[model samples]
Target: MTKAMLLLKFAGLEFSEDRGGYHKAPKGKLPFIDDEGLMVADSTSSVFT
Candidate 1:
C-alpha cells in the first residue's frame, strides 16, 4: 500500500487515497485504483503468476 502511494508521488501523479479494505477491493486484492472506472489491481505477485 505504502509502495503504491510512494510510486504515485515519485511519478508526480495526482491521486486520491482510498482506505477501503480487501472486501471492497478489486477481485479482493489490495492496492488498486479506478482508472476511467476500470478496477486495476496492483499486485507484486502478478509477476509470478
Candidate 2:
C-alpha cells in the first residue's frame, strides 16, 4: 500500500489518503484509487489512469 502511495507521490500527483477500513475495499485489496468516481483496484491499471 505504501508502494502505491509512493508511486503517486513520486509522480507528483495529488491523491486522497483514506484511512478507511479494509473490509470495504472493492476486491479486498489494500491500495486502490478513486478518480472522478472511477475505481481502480489493480496496481498496474492505476499507474496509467
Candidate 3:
C-alpha cells in the first residue's frame, strides 16, 4: 500500500499513507487518498465514480 501511496505522490498528488483502518471504515483495512480539499479514496471504485 505504501508503494501505491508513493506512486500517487510521484504523480504530484497529495496522498495520505493511512492504511491502518478508520473508525468510519471496517477493521483490518486501510485507505490511500489525495486529500487536497476533499478526501479521495484511491481504490478501484474510484474508476467507477
TM-score winner: 2
Quote the lDDT for 28 in model 1: 86
Error of 1 at 14 (Å): 0.4
- Tell me each candidate's TM-score: 0.64, 0.73, 0.37
The C-alpha lDDT values of all candidates are 0.68, 0.79, 0.51
Q: Write the per-residue lDDT of candidate 2 for residues 1-49, one digit (tens) a residue.
A: 5777889899898888887967656788877777777877887878776
Native RMSD of candidate 2 (Å)? 1.8
Q: 2-49, model 3: which lDDT tens digit per residue? A: 555656666786644554557534332456444444544555544345
Candidate 2 segments exceeding 4 Å error: none
- In candidate 1, stretches whose alpha carbon ends up further than 4 angstroms from where it belongs are 43-49
Greater-TM-score candidate between 2 and 3: 2
Off by over 4 Å in 3: 17-21, 26-28, 34-49
lDDT of 2: 0.79
What is the clash tally of candidate 3? 0
Candidate 1 per-residue C-alpha lDDT over 2-41 given as tens digits, one digit per residue, 9 for 90 to 100:
7767767777988898776887677787777676676768
